[model samples]
Target: MNTYLQVAAADASEHRTLIITLFSVFVAATLGVTVWAGRRTKDATDYYAGGRSFSGFQNGLAISGDYMSAASFLGIAGAISLFGYDGFLYSIGFLVAWLVALLLVAEPLRNSGRFTMGDVLAYRMRQRPVRTAAGVSTIVVSIFYLLAQMVGAGALVALLLGVSGDAGKNVIVVLVGVVMILYVTIGGMKGTTWVQMIKACLLIAGTLLITFLVMLKFDFNISTLLGAAAENSGQGAAFLEPGLKYGVSTTTEIDFISLGLALVLGTAGLPHILIRFYTVPTARAARKSVIWAIGIIGAFYLMTIALGFGAAALLSRKEITESDAAGNTAAPLLAQNIGGGADSAGGAILLAVICAVAFATILAVVAGLTLASSSSFAHDLYANVIRKGKASDREEVKAARVSSILIGGVAIVLGIFAGKLNVAFLVALAFAVAASANLPTILYSLFWKRFNTTGSLWSIYGGLSSSVLLVVFSPVVSGNPSAMFPGADFQWFPLNNPGLVSIPLGFLLGWLGTVVSKNEDVDGRKYAELEVRSLTGTGAH
Candidate 1:
């Protein structure tokens, strides 16, 4: 078996042609869709909200595609393959976060928001300051998240195309960046939505097929597969337990909790996900979309268990570890093995299909991130804050297109430098920032009658700054051998994730800022109007 894998590993170059072919097909199809959507996207409403035309089912699939990025598919599967049950926890946390989005955010956001999250947040507050704060939070979270996707794209290109060195990775990053910029600038919301919907279907189908194949190998018995995975893991039964990855010490346990908090709260504040609600016509459509998203996302996560454990059971640890230290290549390698070893025809086909799906995954996610960031800049900052809500629709749309190009350029540059950083950790940091900075302000603005512009601004800045600073000083950045800068020793912060501390601080700052302000009575008087609008969809754009 080892010799077979060795021969398969040596034959990777033979698979490159297949990978290129499938990737070309995917890019061509998506670009065609973008062209069609671009022709129809004439104004700000069409660019940002798809003219509020998506049905619940279509938006639901698009939401699933947007949420399930390369991190969810490749990252989680890789984590589970490398660390066992601890990796499965990420899937659980991500699925649970949708519940927060559905129950707490979806309907109200759809009712109050138009083009961006700032619309909902600044509805009752002073528009300029509030929109500026929301815009900053949106850009911060979107950029962090976009960096992870871009990094993943580089790694995937290197693996699939049999390329090596920084030059190859840089070329791949530029290609991804250019494609994503076009997707957002041309396709806008309508184009991006259809792209997401198509990708979602492909991803779900590919995952299902792979899961079914893995099950067939195990005689359709899940317990048998788990036992085999444990035996192959070399940790005996312990590999099936939670302590393998995240339970090293008291600090690690706290880190796990912090990560959980961020994952659960983050979805409600992700600007791209929030904006999906506005693509639908009404609050009811938004609620229905969340339900559809939860169903699709939950099913996808459940199947990831099969993909992860199947790789563990069927492939040697050394083979998976040596291919990519972070285990990002696990799923594709597993597919190659399961389809009959790398040298076989079936193996090459399966590998190419999975690679295409992964490529589509990154494309859909980065496009959504670009749209969210650009829309926040154009709609919140340029239109509302700078233009005092006097900008023409054409001007706002043009600004959004320009912003997309700038954001995509930044992501490409950062991704080239980021190299092979663990995509999962980058995603977690992005979530923590969203939970800390955006969630508190959103919750208070919608539910707290005393919440004012001062409170919202404080919450956004406090959460954003605290999360970034803590992450900079945390063990993830330095001190630990695996840290980004292993030679540096600036790890004063113990926890890798900052959610446990920063989330509470964000809420505290919001409350304190509101109480210290003199506009309490004035803000309170507006609550009745806000409440009526939020619940009844009155005066909503």
Candidate 2:
């Protein structure tokens, strides 16, 4: 018995070798791709939008890779594993948000802009101010999203390697931040796109394999799987119902509505997603890309159902919670269980492989986010706003590289501070900020002729400030055990998300700022031209 137990313990402790080996292999492969892509990045066009050379299908896969972030893979799976029906609601909201993007944002955005959202917003307004607002907002929103990715990286690596201290996780977070900076600085858009596409494929394959094993175990019956999950959840029938996570209180119900609004509207405004539209050569390709992304992303979320419930059914709640109290490790744990349990070689190999795929997902995602923000800073703030559009291509690209390092540094610092938060919930806060600030300004610029620079400034600044301020004073920051600082009780805002109040206020401020300002004759002419270009792709880069 002692000899047998010794072998098992040896295997358990040494599994991290497999994880490190897999992670290093992926990192080396992606870095090779980055060096290759870096050679082709010759100018602003190449660096910013991959020279508009990507096909609809290629960009589609890249879009799916960028969209299905750690929040989707790790956080949503964890949420569903713990909360059942209410957790699945996140999947529905995320999928539906693509329709909003397709119908309202994608084609027009592709036609109207060159690199950043500022290219479109500054098209009709005063170039400097609008671009400045856009640059600031892009950095803020991308940082919020970046925090979630970093946190996931730290958690996944530390948990799989059995590192028990915050110091190890903190070190991993710094390493991830450094890697993301290298990707953006070295490869630009072409390298980032290829990394995303590869990661997307690996993530999908891993999820599918685990999902298939899960379905086979349950005899391919979803209802049977769900029933078992509920029974195992200890909440019985309540586990399969809507009130398990939300709707328990009136405040909770309203919070759900707020979250729904944010998720539904947020994708259209996200800086990284908006930038994806520019990767394709034309508006038609952009639309095609969105269609492909929706199908792939939709299928992925559907399989999340299997992964989540499968974890709930196969593992005890105590087991899931004990692995990572926030359930962040649920997916890997499920992979381990489905691969013949932890004592077996299959379990260790499967765990390491899935986590490596997840690590790939994190690296690709952070690269995209960093690229978006750095591009905004270089193109909008440094080149256009500060230099008055006279900065040369070499100078602009240099600025973007410098800014990527700085932004990555800031993300590393903030991520360590918010390391304990749920990745999905952190992403929701990002969505709320994007929807409240960027979406209102984008719609006004595209559809409303009377919209002026005053309106744009009011919308972006008002929306950004209000949403951020509310979150700072909300329960998410204090007065709750799960808050960033639970020891303090300074929360004054009631909602967990600020979308309910901030989104409407953004629209109202834009309208109010517009009707009160003098409508310029030059503005009307610019709007007419912008309308033609936005609709018909005339003068598109």
Candidate 3:
């Protein structure tokens, strides 16, 4: 029952110092890579899409890095450790979401857009409004996703450094923000892509190693691992079955469905992930990258079962919860235990390595997010909307760099307040907003010829506003002990996630906006051109 291993006071300082030093070295190495990549980034194309020089496998690795965020590693592993079978649902929903991206969005998005998703939406619609809406939606979604990565960084690093107070976590969050801003402004897509590829490889390797150790701990028998997790989790048989977490009440069940919907549909709409397609040379390369990504991400997610259950089997519930209430520290703590517990030199080294990988994960993800949002601002709103697409490449790239700083600042502030929520849960909010605002308009634009500016504007703004408002009033924000503001009680919406309601509303609003529009500003010729370009990649940039 006392499986929660703690370092002796004398060794704790030594462990903390080692972890910090190793982590610093990794950060410095990544920054050097970014600086080197920045030297090659000389144009708008290079800044926005990494010169489109990355091969399928490289881009796929980068995409895997972007998708397998802090939520995928720290959050989901923790979720599994704490909630058992219900926790595994997050991984399932996340992995399954990629199929939707591969089949419906990836190739077309790559073939159609140049720099940003706004490019595709603005191609046929009124340039200003659609691009503006897209830029706004991209930034909003990116910030939401960024919060999870940033918060995960705070929780993980705080635990690694043996800094128990909010002050230390907040400082780490700010440091992460500053570092990510540097990555985006200096590295652009080229730097960001390389960082992501490295992170992805490290993350997968780390996960595999831990998984192997966990299996070995149980003599490589999965059933044995599951049984130990069930017994050790304090939930007995229920820990291995449904309703341990989400099905406790009718409201919670509906919330689970909403969360599932968001996770399934959100990836296609995430600006950072979508932009990775543009880093490849051609539409075929984009498709190939996705296939590679699916394989990497799939394998990594499968190993999360071992990581999660391993933590449950090895660490007590109180140990996991007390480390961090949301269980974000479970993965790193699990690593410590399997590496010979806290007192051993092996435990300290392994813990430092895994946490360093996690820190790198946060940095890579946040940099991608900042780039996506800042690129949307520079490419869509500033160049196209404000300057009517006449801005020089240098000017636009400069604008992106400037905007990245601002966006990074906002993410840091929001992340400090959102430290208590689960990173995976925060990502679901991003997903709900993306599924509501971005995905509906994207699908309509690609498929429906009648989808015009009115439809685009309506769906985006309606979906964005509805989903955000619902979230602001939902239990995730307030009304519950686990809320962002636990003392307040403003929740009126029953579900924790808004995807179930806002997703349908988005599609319906798009149709209604087009059908009822009196302007009738349909650009038939442009639609035909877009369709041809999207299908055959004849005129694709």
Decreasing TM-score order of the candidates: 3, 2, 1
Task: Kindly indicate the candidate among 1 and 3 with the higher lDDT.
Answer: 3
The clash numbers for all candidates, in the given order, read 0, 0, 0
Worst 10 residues of 2 by lDDT: 1-10
lDDT of 2 by residue, 63-174 (tens): 9999999999998988899999888888998899999899999999899989999999999888999999999999999999999998899888876776656798899999
Highest-scoring model, lDDT: 3
Candidates in order, TM-scores: namely: 0.97, 0.97, 0.98
Model 2 CA lDDT for position 388 = 99
lDDT of each prediction vs. the true structure?
0.88, 0.91, 0.92
lDDT of 1 by residue, 376-478 (tens): 9999999998999999999999999999999899988877766656677778889999999999998998898888888998999999999999998998778
The TM-score between candidate 1 and the true structure equals 0.97
Native-to-model Cα distance after best TM-score fit, residue 474 in candidate 1, in Å: 1.6
Candidate 1: residue pairs that collide: none
